[model samples]
Target: MSIPIWKYALSMLTYFVVLLCITELLRKKYKLANIVWICSLLTFPLWLMGGVSGWFRWAKILSVILPTIVVGFCRIANFEERKGSFWEFFQKGWILWFVYGMLFLNILEATLKDVSLGNYANAACGFLLCATIPFAPKFWEYSKTGEGDLICYTTVGWNFLYTTWNLCFVYGESPNYFASTICILMAAELYPIFKKKPELYIMSRVYTLATHMILRSCFGTMFLKVMDASTWYNASFAKYWGILNFILIIPYLFWYMWQLHTGKAEISFKRGKTNNNVTTLNT
Candidate 1:
């Protein structure tokens, strides 16, 4: 089937604009954020009643819920710097690892899907992508703001890799959804990249992904039909993406490991801007 290029372009732009607007609002308005958070939580029961069950659906729920929890925790704890608060102990001592672990699990979900699909090359790429994550508390430190909290590890390079890897995963696993899904990815990156605030990546991603999933779930038939700009997939296409991801991730992962080994890891690929906790290893 042929995709209408103009229609796809327009749709992508529309989704990007809408997601950015919602994310910006959530970033500024705590009450509104709470409302959206509650609605996102409610989707779980709705999905259950509607008989929605899948790793991806659960992942989507967790994606929204977990980030909302982080924001809420940041708001309640309200500590400036790492004061010796019990909340700080809870957050840094265990919550950090928990968050990172959940993020890793999300990535692993797609990796397993690739493996099950017999796309070994993409599966290996997924594994390598997982390896590159800096799961240490140092890397997962929270940055609190008046609006909410965000993790500091999502640098430009890391965001690029993640967006690419996730895009590849979607294209391989659900090619029909790939077109609309890309708009969400793009929306996640645009504001953060433009503002040079990589820490906002997770927040933006949560808003975009949660909104997309909720809309898609509620209106699957119409949503797919409208966004069905392209619907063709082939083994060769998946293989190409698999190899491409490997090519992009391998050296990047090696460099990250080397930085960890040398005890000089900078979160951003660009020089002169290192994380405050970069002196410590991510082990």
Candidate 2:
């Protein structure tokens, strides 16, 4: 079935508006964001039963992990990045490394799912993406201000790779919902673009993903029912995207490692400025 351009456009527009609002509310206010954080945690089991993962084991894993990501990311945002605080301890402590671990688990879930579905090409890409995780912790810098100033300071290069990898994962897992899901992903990227703050990428992604998951839970057939959107799944479509993800990520991973080895990785501070000489992690 051919989906009209207008339908895609409308879906994109609707998601962009709704998600941007959710992101802003979560980003700009501490109390509200905290409320959402609490609510999301409390509602976790409900989300699992809310038609969230369907029959996909990967989706079930994601249903658990994503909300946890939201909570952890929010807690990182909740702490003031000043001296002698728990937040400071978290940044310095070994526990903070779990942040990266959680991220790796999230990616692995999708990769494993791709493998189970016989998406060999995408699974290969997913494993390659996982390989990049050890190198990833250095790329992100986290901080929060008074009220709601949770900032991740994610760089452009890293976010681009992540967004592309995730898009391919979604394509592999839920091609039938790709059109609508693309809107959510695009909206996530758009938040950073519109805000003119590249650091907002991860923050935007966390909230938008949470919001989309909630919507999916509550209105499982929203896109098809409300928008009259067409849905289809194709192995070739999934395979081609998986192939593309693999091809694109391999060179970038090599380049990333080269940068690290050469002591030239883009390391950003809280303000998002790059320090080329500093090899160790900077927060």
Maximum-TM-score candidate: 1
TM-score of candidate 2 relative to the true fold: 0.78
The TM-score values for the models, in the order shown, are 0.82, 0.78
For residue 121, give model 2's deviation from the true position in Å: 1.4
Query: Candidate 2, residues 1-283: lDDT per residue as tens digits?
Result: 5667787787768877887887887777655665665565556566566555545643644554455454454354335434555445444533335555666666788788788878888788778767765434455444433333334554455566677777777766666666667777888888878987776676677677767766666566666553433355666876887888788888877876886688655543234375332212234
The models' CA-based lDDT, in order, is 0.68, 0.62
In model 2, how large is the Cα lDDT of residue 241? Answer: 78
Q: Mind giving the per-residue lDDT tens digits that candidate 1 earns over 1-283?
A: 5657787777778877898888788767755675777666666655666545787767766765766656555534443443556546444456666667766777788888888887777778778777777765666554444553555465466678888888877887778788888899999888787767776676677667767777766565554665773466676887888878778878887878787788776534323454443222122
Clash-forming residue pairs, model 1: none
